[model samples]
Each structure stands twice: as structure tokens, then as C-alpha cells.
Target: MTVVNKLTRLLNITYPIIQGGMGNISDPNLAAAISNAGGLGTIGVGDLPINEAVYKVTEMLKQTSNPCCVNIPIAVHPNVSHIVQQMINLKVPVVSLSAGNPAPFISLLQQHKIIVICVIATVRQAKKAEKAGADIIVCEGYEAAGINAKNESTTMTLIPQVVQQVNIPVVAAGGIADGKGLAAALALGASGVQMGTRFIATKEAPYHKIYKQAIIQATDESTVIVGRRYNRIRRLIRSEYASKLLEIENKNDDPAIFFKQTTENYHKIGAFDGDIKNGFINGGQIAGLIEDCPSVYDLLETMTADAKQILKQSLEKLE
Candidate 1:
């Protein structure tokens, strides 16, 4: 069953699900797999050098002809301008910007006929992104993994407010892991959904087996937020390293120390190297909901089928 909406029509995808660009984990294999499976796959170029980032995108393009997206963490990428130029040169179909004002580059991307989606965590940010000419808005709530907004609004509250504030299509993120969550997002007035933590547990994801297993075993209380003192709050699966990092953060340790703990290198160590004791893995409260590591195609198929059933049942209830 196809879940069509503004997002699907705009992107020409079979489903409205957009895979979260989980930095190092969003490699070509997984991105292409997701895109090939009918959803928009994303390659996250979080702080990667321009050449390497371009190589990843190029590899993904080679693997699949379907539309895919590249995520640019503006605040962390040292060469935002160069990255955008590369995406334009490659004729990338979609781009999602996060962690900074997207006003400067939104027009530039749109000029090249690229669909730009801005990730926002607040109603004000949604309005600003829409005004900046963003084709779509992905409202990420506090329950999301990785870096989150200081205000920490949950998806249930943030999606409706953003939908009310923006005329453009809205994609809900954070704490959403299954078909039930997708139905809830649609009920909240969102046209689509973005998933990160749940995707991390998929077989195609480049993260280590241990990382995927952790997600399967995680409980509702298994996650924790670190770096609150520095205002760069991040959610992660609680582990020895994360606990220590939290200890330092709680003590009001040097900001640099806290910063070092959350760098991309540590993320790679935990996610790719499976160094759970000394490295940290990003995860959301949705970790508790994942049960297995299925292929991307199987997962999306199941999710879409389940969503249709859930939505149909919900409508029957109202009747």
C-alpha cells in the first residue's frame, strides 16, 4: 500500500518516510537501499571534508537512480558553501539543513531546482524556515537522538504547532519508531515522518552489530541526555562512557571536555567500532520500541502496511 501525500508527490517517492541522516552511519549502501525501497534515503555529511562528502554522495548516486537527500549540519560543517556547491554540481535532488539558520543557502539550493527541507525544533523556527523558502519542514522534537533543542518539546506537541504555523508540508521526527507513530503524526497534521534511531537498527545501516543490538535491548529508561551544561544536549544509549560523560557534565566541567566527548570521532567509535565501553552511541526513546534488525525494504514495507491498517481501524472507530 502506498502512503501518498505532499511529501511523496514533491519528492516522487513511493512512501513519505524519510530516513534520518545519522552522520557516519548514513553511508551509500544504506542510503541507496532505503531509496530503492521507496523512501528517501539521506547521506549525512556531518563535518566531513568536502571531497569525502562528495565521494559519498557520488557513490550513492551510482547505486540508485532514485531521489535521495544529503544532510548538511551547517553549524558543524567547516565548508558549508563548498558542500552546497558540490551538491549543486552533482544535481542532488534534495537537501536537509539543520543546526543553523538555513536562510542563506535555501535560495541557492532552490535556484538549482533542489528541494530544500529545513529541520526545526520550534514553531518560530518553522515559520522562519518557511519564510526562507524551504520546500518542507522537518520538526524534530526533544525525544530525537543526537543534538536536540534546548526547549525540549516532544513530537506530540511540536508537530501540530508547526503545522499550524507553516503552510508548507511538515515532517514529524523524534520518538517515532513504527506504524502507530506514523499514524499519530498524520493525525497531528503532518504530511510525513523522519526516522533516525529506528533506522540505526536496520541491517543495511553501517553501524556495528553491537550498536544495533543495543537498540533492540534498550528500554524506555535506557537512554540519557548529556552536555546540558553547554547547551548542546544530546541523547544517547546509556553506557559506561556516557555515564562518565554525564558525570563530567553534571560537575560543570570544562566546556571543551564536554565538547570533546560528543565529537564525531566518539560517535564513530561507538557506532562503527562497537566500542561500547569507551564510546557512546546516539539513540532516542524510540530505542525501546525496536525489536529486530530487518532489511530496509522489509522494514519500510511492514511499516507502511501497519500504518494503513492502523489508520483504517482508527477511522472505523470514529464511524
Candidate 2:
């Protein structure tokens, strides 16, 4: 039996699973792998130059004929217009905007007939995004890795609230790693689910072996939020570098100091180079649930199958 929803029909994918566009980690190979597996793959262009972003998208296009998405964190990238134009020029099928308002660029992307998905953390933001012409809303909760909203809403609370507030399809994000999580999101009225940390441990992901190992070895307490004191909340694996950053944050260090520690360079070193001592790795609370590295195909196939069985069992119990 196939599960279908607005999200699946909108993107024309076989599954409602979306690969979270992790900066530096969302490479062409990984994106193509997920897309080829009948899920939405996203290429994350976090603060990269417009030309580089175009090149990455171009490379992704060459890998798979399947539809892929390009994610633009509006707050970090300076030339938003240029990047949007590049996507339009390339005929990218979908675009996901995050970290800032989508009102300004929504119409431009819509004009090109590209499906626009806005990442929001609050009911107010979800409503605003819908009004601003977002084709879909990805309700990312605080349990997610990287920058999170100050309200710190969990996926359980945020997904249902956003679904109730918006008419558009709501894709649940954060703290979702398995078929059980997928079933829970569906129960909460989410049309689909997006995963970040869970995908990091996959074989197709370009992250270093050690980074994947860290996720597999993580426990419920192995991850912690580091930048809360500075108001730039981010969840990361508990490491010497992360611990040091937390210690400095507690001491009320300069914002610049904290900013330096959280730069993309550090992310590259830790995530790509496996330099855990000098760099930190970003992960979500769901990291604790990951046990092995599988190919994207195997992961998604098993997840969907498990979700079908679990949901079926749940319905029988209700009867």
C-alpha cells in the first residue's frame, strides 16, 4: 500500500519524506541518492556565494532526473535575489526558505511556478507564510539541530498547532528519526516529515565516518544545546569543543567570540574532517535513536514499510 498526501503530490515524489538541507553536508551525491529513492532531496546552500550555489544545484541536476530542492536560509545569504534568480534560471522544481521571512521572495519564486516551502517554528509564522504564498509549511521544532527558535517548542507541540493554524500542508520536522516518529507526525496532522540528524548517519551522506559514528554512539543525554545563553540556540553532540563553548557561553563572553566558534568553518572541520577535538558537530535529540549507517534506499524503504505496519496495528487497536 502506498501512502499519499498533498506533500507527495505537490512534489510528485513517492514518499512524503524530505531530506533536511544541512549546510555543507547536503552534497550532490546525497541529494540525488534521496531523490532517486523517491523522497525529496535538498541541496543546502547556507551562506555560500550565489555562483557556488548555482554550481551545486547544477551538479545535483546532473545526478538525478528526480525533483530536488534547494534550501536558502534567508538570513545568512546576502544575495537572496541572485540565488532565487539562479534557481529560476536553472528551473529548480522546489525551493525551501528558512531563518527569515518568506514574504519578499515568495511571489518571485511563485512566478516561476516553483513550489515554495517555508520553514517556520511558530503558528504566527506558519500563518504569515501561507498568506505570503508559501506552497507548503515545514514546521521545524526546537528539537531539531542547528539554529532554533527562542520559544523552544518540541515537534509534538509545534506540528499539531501549525497544522491547525494553516490551510496548507504541514511537514513535521525535528526529533523525528524512525517509522514510529513518522506515524506520530501523521497522527498529529502533518502531511509529511523532514529529517536532518537521522540522515547524517546514512551511507549516502558525505559526513566523515567519525561524525556518523558519533551519532550512532550518542545516547539521550549525549546531545545538548550550546548557544542558548547568546540567544542563538543550537543542539550539538557533547564533545570537548562543545563543552568548552558552553563553558565560555556561561561566562558571558562577547557575542563575536561565540559567533566565531559557531562559524561554518568549524562545522566543516567537525562534520566533514572529523576533527572532534577542535570542532563541534551539530545533531538533534534523535541522534540517540540512530544505530547504523544504511544506504538512503534501504533507510527510506524500511521506514515507510515500518510506518505502514505500525499505523495499521494502531488502527486495529483502536477498533
- Winning candidate number (lDDT): 1
- Model 2: lDDT equals 0.90
Candidate 1 at 318: error in angstroms? 1.8
Summed over model 2, clashes come to 0
Candidate 2 lDDT tens digits, 1-319: 3568888989999888998988755688889999999999999999887777888899999999998999999988888878888899999999999999889999999898999999999999999999999999999998898778999999999898889888999999999888999989999999989998998998888889999999999999988898877888888998888988888898866878898888888888899999988888999999999999999988888888888899999999999
Candidate 1 per-residue lDDT, tens place, 1-319, comes to 6877888999999988998878755689899999999999999999988888999999999999999999998998998999999999999999999989999999999999999999999999999999989999999999999989999999999999889888999999999988999989998999989999988888888888999999999999989998888988999999988998988888865899788777888898899999978789999999999999999988888888888899999999999
Candidate 1 colliding pairs:
none
All candidates' TM-scores? Answer: 0.98, 0.98
**Candidate 2 residue pairs in backbone clash:** none
Model 1 lDDT vs. the true structure?
A: 0.91
Off by over 4 Å in 1: none
